[model samples]
Target chain A: MSIHTLEVLVENEPGVLARVSGLFARRAYNIDTLVVGPTSNPEVSKMVIQVNLEGHSLEQVIAQLDKLISVISIEELVEGAKKPVKDTQPDYQN
Target chain B: MATTHVPTANGTVMNGATSLVKSLEAAHVDVMFGLPGGAILPAYDPIFDSTIRHILVRHEQGAGHAATGYAQVTGRAGVCIATSGPGATNLVTPLMDAGMDSVPLVAITGQVPSAAIGTDAFQEADIRGITMPFTKHNFLVTKADDIPRAIAEAFHIATSGRPGPVLVDIAKDALQTQTTFNWPAKIELAGYNPKIVPDNQSISDAAALIAQSKKPVFYVGGGVIKANAHKELAQLVELLGAPVVTTLMARGAFPDSHPLHLGMPGMHGTVAAVTALQKADLLITLGARFDDRVTGKLSTFAVNAKVIHADIDPAEINKNKFADVPVIGDLRETITALIPALKSALAKNSQDLAPWNASMQKLKSTYPLGYTLPDDGSLSPQAVIERIGKISGTETIFTAGVGQHQMWASQFISYEHPRTWLNSGGAGTMGYGVPAAMGAKVGAPDSTVWAIDGDGCFQMTNQELVTCALNNIPIKVAIINNESLGMVRQWQTLFYEGRYSNTSLESKRVPNFPMLAEAMGCVGLSCERPEDLDATIEKAMSINDQPVVVDFRVHRDAMVWPMVAAGTSNDEIMIARATAPDWDSQEL
Candidate 1:
């Protein structure tokens, strides 16, 4: 299994978030982390979803998500680029 | 802020409920199935003024299934309405069933007032949240002005692409408030554009594969019927001159009497059909999703075949199995394009597939569908279904609740046209027969609709018979009463060492179906003797003004033959239990 991040842009409408999350839930796909916020366009909302799944299952989940009527676009995030990093303490020895 | 309210051109200010009804009328929704309640009273108030005819169902579940039945018959989005809380929850089963089967339906429910939402007010429920997982899309209308657009979008989403149920939960206050209603000329759903035209390259590739293959099998599914591509599919099948196997949901998609038709393929499918699919080299799956039931032990199923999966839904293409060439678009359009492509590509080659055809024909004749009649005088379920098929002929729309009866109907009936058979294929929801039959009769008023139900399934949703009687829907219901959950009992008998656990229904305590039908204003008849079968069916067929119910008490131990037990490969199919033979080993 691999961890993949999908960035989805959807129409900013009521229940759009539910539609996205509900898609994952219905398929029984686990979501590691999900973050939603306003996009640059006021009419659209951006959702960053991280899921741990096999390649085939991830492809299916993405395809299913794309079929949603409210979903505008979807992009998978690369491993090293713009990853969310946790805060680290200063090393005393260094 | 000062604002002036402008009335519509007709000088009529419409409320949310009125606007919703008007939008349905604009969509040409002539019939609806629903039950009214407190929050949805406003919607019902305008029904009298609208041209839409509403059937008051006995229960919300019945209404939803009725809508699914209507959608399956008309190829349009069937509309249903319900009130808040329990009423909305009651629609969950049918919505999920519709979602699984890809039936087009639009369900509108009244929610608690906007101010009362989330307050746990009386009759308050988050219906949008509840139906989110199953519905294609759902809307929660907080404002009165959004009614028209929401209704239009719901209809569009429900009927387009991979069709399924869409829910619109309108707040009670929205229904009560007034607004200037203007029907939108076109829907503006930016993300919902379905690709109706197939990619030409993919079509040509599929056509080339079809033309070159020596042993090809066309695996069709409900999508063929859903897309109304029967004509195109039949043309392609005839062009390829290959055997065709229609899945359970696709029983009527292809004519059963066709020369190349190899009955259904699944757990209860014909041996020849299953054997052909398992051994075929090229599998051209048209709109079939390769469900687990159809693919027993998927790793070994069609291992020798290179699949050409053509489906309207792109998600279903590679969901279960890898597709060598995927044609993603509407089935009708894809098949229409592929037909000519195959004709041009296969014009020169006259590759004869005599040996394969001969082998299939041999298999078909060798182990034909058979069941033994009991010497005791009790009726066999298969015989009953076969007799019904013979009497009903090709024009009747036969529906079934899931069981041995459903398999028998699928095996025995000859469906000459599309949309003549409706059932819950994916969900296998019991109690679907009666309401679905009612909806089918309503959708095709001139056609004879039959609901062949098992006794176990009939008790689940038989209350819809009251709705049928009151609505003057003349549907025929034949209950195969085995006094047990026949399918489950058979499994238990085979796999569970003859231990029948809670499968037997206490028919003695339960009201007799014939008497119950009589109480519900339907003509009821009970047939027990095998000789009475033909006469009973003829008597039931004679009734045209009111609904009729015939209870046939079949033998409880009679099991469906040619069984391929779950998880077993198709090669392991058992015609029947082997018995000891008289020995003459000395001569051998």
Candidate 2:
């Protein structure tokens, strides 16, 4: 399993976090750390999820996450979280 | 907008419940199955006066399964409703069933007041939280105005893409709160776009592989049925002239009687079909996920076959077996494109499939499906099921509960059309047959629908017969009464040294199926002898005014053959007791 981080942008709606994390729990994918909070846009939320999985399984996870209606887009944090998170976003764990 | 005073063009401002009814009407929902409780009572008020027919089922599980059945037959989202807490929780099985089988289902549930939510108040449950993993998508409606949008989106999500269950849990307070009603609500799903068109490159690659391969098999699965790609699949089959094998969930996706058909594959599949896959050089996997049941000991299955896996769901591709050419998109469009590409490829350099065709024909004709009569000389479940199919013809929609009877129904029946067979394939839910058959009848009133159930499975959700009787659904039910959980008993005998344990249902007579059927206001019949089989079946078929139940007291010793034990390789299939078919000649 390789460590990888993803930045997912989703709608600032109820149960959006559950929808994201619940997918991992159900599909038996591994998660290292996940943080979710409000973004610059009030209507959107930002999630930085770190997972320890194979490269292909990561793609599968991302593809499944992309299927959630609330999720707008996802980007792999290629540089690996040079900064933990933006100051404007709250420190939330899920 | 929350409007208590303002009036719309149609009438006075309505509550969330009334708005939901109007939205459902707009969605063209002619029938819905549901039950009412405290939180859902407010919604029942508007439904009382609406044009949409509400089918009151005895249980919420029935409502959910009924919706799935309706969706499977109608190719539309089946709608079900229930109250909060227990009522909503009861629908969990059906949600999982729809999720497993990719049936389009819209489930509307009542939640505790938004204020009472997360408080463990009376009848309060986080239905949205409970079902988040099972549903394609879900919404917890707090604002009264969100009801219409949620309904619209739920309908859209449930019926689109891969077509699975969607949940819209409405807060009780929202339903009671006054809200402006709107029609043609906008769907705002930003990240839910499913790819309908495949890349031309992948299509061309798949075509090239198919054209050059001497031994190729069309490994069909349930996605073909969900995608409604039978016409395109037929066209592709005619173009390639390859042997086709449909999976359990895909039993009716391809015509069973087609000249190149190899029957079903995997565990409990036909010898020819399984061998063809075991020996194939290329597998043209179309809309079929390589399910564990179909690909027993995945490493050993189709080991020689180069894969051309095509599916609408991206996750399914390469999830199990590696896809040599992964075609990701809606299968109808993918196959539609591949047909022409394959034609051009065939025009270039087509492999001589004559040798492969001869081998497959030899396999199919040599090891045709057959079963021996029991020593006690009772009715055979296979014969009864086959006769049911033969008499009713392909026009009849057949649904089965999970067990030996389900296997018999899948194997015995000849399916020549799509959407003609429905079963709890992925979830393998035991009580799926009766309610799904009821739903199928509601969706297709002109055709005959039969629920072929085992005695063990039938008892789980048989209470829905009362709903069928009251609603004028004339679906027939045939209970293959083997007197026990026959599948379990078979495993016990095979693996557990015949210790039996708790696998006895006391076959002689417990709760007489015929009497129970009559009690439920259905025309009940029982057939114990072979001579009475046709007469009883014909009688069941003739009854068109009310629901009918016929219990065929089949021999309890019967077991499903062509067995590949769980986690074993498909190469080790047993055609019958102590018999493995000759596989030496399968050079392909």
Candidate 3:
């Protein structure tokens, strides 16, 4: 099993993060690295969620991510894209 | 000539009040319950016109508890707002309640202006520092620019991992600041990320043990309820064919009607559940931390069983009992993973429950939650609880404080649905019932709410009674008045050689609760004997204009049945001595 990094673009609003985090939380997704920052567009922000998965669990994560209404775009940043950056190391769990 | 850079006093670029609303809206705070005050006037001014519904609470504590109730019921962070000094201090009770119960809540307060912060200015208090230990995290935002981040941080700290309450303080000047506000809906907290899955090997090992064990039991906790994994828990338990013993918080996670459900297992647990745990070969604990009340003198707890503990919080994993297998992950994920693994393991082997099932049934008939309800006059706490339960029925929401009353309520009440019964389980805060009941009412405004409490426990925060009256929150307060600290007395009689010192409140100068209720502008009823109990409670519960408090003068020495005496194993619970009825069993 390896950790996968996912970049998610979402609408900027209150509870958007809670909904996303709660989705991962309720589904039992082990979030490792989550980075959210305002993009050039004021009404949208990019969230990078890193989670470890066994086998095909990453597919489930991607599918779940698409279900959130606030999520505009999601791309897996593991293996090929950005090739496993050390800075993406998992930080502390809140 | 005056170039002191005062930032234009009140009309500066940052209006701390508006910023708070924008930040709260950014945090997706749907509603906020609070009472307006002089110190928090700036914040209220904007809230009056904001999209976020602001409820005017009777007391600051009520606001806090309402948020707690909302959070507990909805599994989202409940939000409340209050002013400085007295208002902030009042929010403490509910904040502490939420913290103790592991409910996610966000409490925002308006502090005195920065210039008047520590001078005890008419409504000035250091709420941030005072609430530090009791909260998951707290922040005192001095700069107006930090208002959004502070609120965002509070919400993050409150709802993430090991959920609890968080407090944010905004100075009056900060609320009045006028600044460029772009509410960022999402946040990236650097120091906060809760683990949601266990190491694969630990999960494999736990699954293996469950497969090999002949007799196994699953101990569930509030974590299962909070994680919304009740169905998953049931699935796993069914897969393993194990009996479940729930902590106070975990009630309703496993249907009590299930053949394998053993009800609550702890200081006041059932004999069947406790005995099942004692005789098990392996204990698969999910979302439950080993609380002392559940595992008396840890050394003797489940001596025959090896523990496979799974919890979301890492600190709780090996804190109490050593685990043969420790799984740190969200309960839903852990259970989801265990189900498939256990199914695979069980496919290779088979076991029968005939022997284990027979033993549990024997314990149930031996020491059921039984008590004789007298037809005559002397009041029994059990009878009082039974009557209340009968009236509330299965659909009503019941909340209790920590005391003999709480135990009695847990015993007598039949909770059919999950989250219907709320209480301060682990923290054991005495004055929690009323506030919590009030909170539950706010959560389900149309549902019947009953706050059951003991005389000793009620007085701890009886002040909230006023909050109920002022808010017209019609919750029935059932006071099991033995006129003494019943739990302590029972402990003294059972363990400490019967040295009932300082247990009796007979001589202590306490206010007349009924009269106090009247003074607080609520209806009060007192029942000195069993004959008046039924009608009195019915009348009290019927009141719709204001809250009602009923003091039921119960038997002083009455103890909650099936109690596991301290330092003793759960198997050795003391049943409600079925022999004596105290002679006054029927009369006043």
Q: Give the top-scoring candidate (DockQ).
A: 2
Q: Point out where model 3 deviates above 4 Å.
A: A1-94, B1-14, B35-39, B51-59, B85-90, B115-125, B197-201, B372-377, B470-472, B495-500, B506-521, B531-546, B576-588
Q: How do all the candidates rank in terms of lDDT, highest first?
A: 2, 1, 3
Worst ten in a row by lDDT for model 1 chain A: A85-94
Residue range with the least summed lDDT across 10 consecutive positions in model 1 chain B = B579-588
* Chain A TM-scores of all predicted models: 0.83, 0.82, 0.80
Tens-place lDDT digits, model 2, residues A1-94: 7778888899998778888888999899978999998889999999988999885687678667767878887777766444322231111100
Model 1 has a DockQ score of: 0.27
**What lDDT would candidate 3 get against the real structure?**
0.75
Q: True-contact fraction for model 1?
A: 0.55
Report backbone clashes per prediction.
0, 0, 25
Indicate whether candidate 2 or candidate 3 has the larger DockQ: 2
lDDT of 3 by residue, A1-94 (tens): 7887888888785556776786677668788889999999998898988888864466556644553435666666756675322143121121
By DockQ, is 1 or 3 better? 1
Candidate 3 residue B145 C-alpha distance from true site, Å: 1.8
What lDDT does candidate 3 reach at residue B567? 82
